[model samples]
Target: MTAIPSAELHTPDELLANASAMYASGDPKLFRGAILESITALEAFVQRTVFRSLEGRLDPLLVKWLEEKTRMDFDSRLSVLTQVATGLPINKSSELWDGYKKAKEIRNKVVHSGRKVTAMDVELVMASVRDWLSYLGTTVELEAVLLTLKRWVEQSPKPPIENEAQAIQLVAQYFHQSAAARITIEAEINTGGRRHRADMILDFGPRKVLVETKFPRLANNVRNVIRDAVEQADAKRQAANIGQACVIAFLRKRPEGVSDVVERHKGGGILSIAIETH
Candidate 1:
């Protein structure tokens, strides 16, 4: 297959368009590879734009511009980009930083390792591409606005107030939005037995669900975590009149022991949920 010509005058929107086209081409392998390439290109563009914009004085107009153009909360949005773009050793941030790390890993396997890229992989890569493009568009637009603001600040006679409120508000909103159910972590059990802190607790009305997260990379660890969670849940239930209680062994990746574990625990209330995070 002939390679598509590299996009010239690279822009976030253009990169996104190319990705969409590649995804629509009906070939899973090609689509996945193209999406990865598009992400790489988009990240490079954002880094360049951000560095160039930062050369001049910071100004409030930049914040206004971001709000007006992207409809994102000014402080929160800028902080996210800055953290990923600056203070990081990599010129291009990690794929995980942009939430595409998992997609990139799958793409690498499909493209270089002769692994078959599934339709689900293509769909996921396409979604990641879209998110990358959206982030790029917002960042690029902010850079342009920042440049304008810098010029205005340099020439203006009056000094502007330092708007740290935007930064504070941004952090607060981020924590609020990403907030998860609080699960206590400890090293001992109430029964004077040694135990690991609860990894996660899911409250379901009359039933309480407990989960221990484990990486599939370690088979024994995964089994142990699941077993421990189940045992803990069982113990907790024995002391109280709880309804529909179960311990979940959660794996972020598929493990080889999954089948054996499931078979052994068949008809038991123990469950497993496969999750992947980027």
Candidate 2:
């Protein structure tokens, strides 16, 4: 896990962070914080991606007019941003307009009519904004790191890796200097059996992620490695009092039913990402 520094958090990230904090407090009224923040996050994403990209495309006078005369209201901004993004080659079209419309409508009701939004309202808004934000190149820091890792794995050589150590090294090559500083290799912890060694441990201040690497050639071999890695990750996580962990399986062939396993463990704070080399 890569820790995102507070300084590097974009507007959407910061809003989501606040929303998460409020949600975790178990106060129902505070759910509004999540809704409001989600709206702001969507607006900020539009400014960052759509508005910023138009820096040189529009006439200077027109740009200045927009800056000075535009309503800066949520709906107005969203409309302009969507229009511009849809027309620009640099921007990707989104399928999130329906969700965006719903979110904005709910925001209007809540703010204009003093309405109370349920947990579902907040969840819906967040889910909708997430896609738009992602398309606009805005995401939480950890998500950004994970995306980079996925891209690295996809771009890596197709030949199977030699061993666990080589696979670990390959993953490490993608880490930034700051991330590299927080990594611990072969970290030892007491787990009833003298010393239980974790292949890698990433310390992200509040979140610790245990990573296990494996190179599997056969179907049975993949299962065995996954079992061992999950056990190792669990032991390390329990010892460290951390809840997040993942197993990276560098595979010659993806085993049948492995995707189901990955989906099952997703909500349980464990991830199984199979990186195919063949």
Candidate 3:
């Protein structure tokens, strides 16, 4: 497969520049054209970056369906596909998303029906698109999260978390105190029709993840405990658009036994971390 030439990839900035130029020309007739360029910018970002990111992350068939067969609107790409492939959670109800959705509607009215858009309409689309792009730098990166956790667990004194609850609280506090990013953690998030509570729900700006904690002191099958936590997290994750993770804190010490369960699920997007006792 021939790679897409880098020069051919249109960034949001470049397209926005063109859109802004049109918007500033003082022509209502060109307002729709400007909005059209903005929509193209969104598509370019998704097609160029998102599809490539999913090469090995998702199954080939699903990836094909998502990229080719599915006629995903902007909302679907932002709210669903991007999250599935990249773990970048997007809350559709956020003010940024709400604004982009309005911009999309305005663009649709202009493009799909050939209707005239006002000066305010063009400004709304430009502002909304820029707002969504501003968070790209801060979106959740799974490796970064795991790296942060690794550092937290390896601290000199170690986190003195005794049970699952303490682990959750301490983990939440750790994220809150983090200098790089102050993640918002909510406790006992009800997912799957509120049938169960996810131990800790973290908001990483444009991303969200539900965490399940396990503190097994005497359990013989530690692998099974971790696997069960992964399954629980996966279920909760599937119920919503958020990502999932399992944080297992050892009350005694880290179990040195596991048959690739940790490695396998980490690849599956349910990050399982063990806080070893030092």
Please provide, for model 2 over 145-178, each residue's C-alpha lDDT reduced to its tens digit, 9 standing for 90 to 100.
Answer: 4434544455655454667778887665544244
**lDDT ranking of the models:** 3, 2, 1
**Candidate 3 residue lDDT tens string, 16-45:** 788988888988778888888877876676
Looking at candidate 1, the ten consecutive residues that score lowest on lDDT are: 1-10
In model 3, the Cα lDDT at residue 31 comes to 85
lDDT value, residue 65 of candidate 1: 62
Candidate 3 lDDT score relative to the true structure = 0.61
TM-score of 3: 0.46
lDDT of 1 by residue, 1-278 (tens): 12212112233445556666766787775766665666565455554555344333245476446435543332333345443333222224655345566666776687688777666776677666556544443334323332333233334444322332332232123222212222233222344354434443433232343433343345457666666656666565344433223332323344665432111132233443332221
Backbone clashes for every candidate come to 1, 0, 0
Decide which is better by TM-score, 1 or 2: 2
Superposed model 3: Cα runs more than 4 Å off: 1-12, 137-278
Model 1 TM-score relative to the real fold: 0.34
After superposition on all CA atoms, what RMSD does each candidate show versus the true structure?
Answer: 21.5, 13.0, 11.6
Which candidate wins on TM-score? Answer: 2
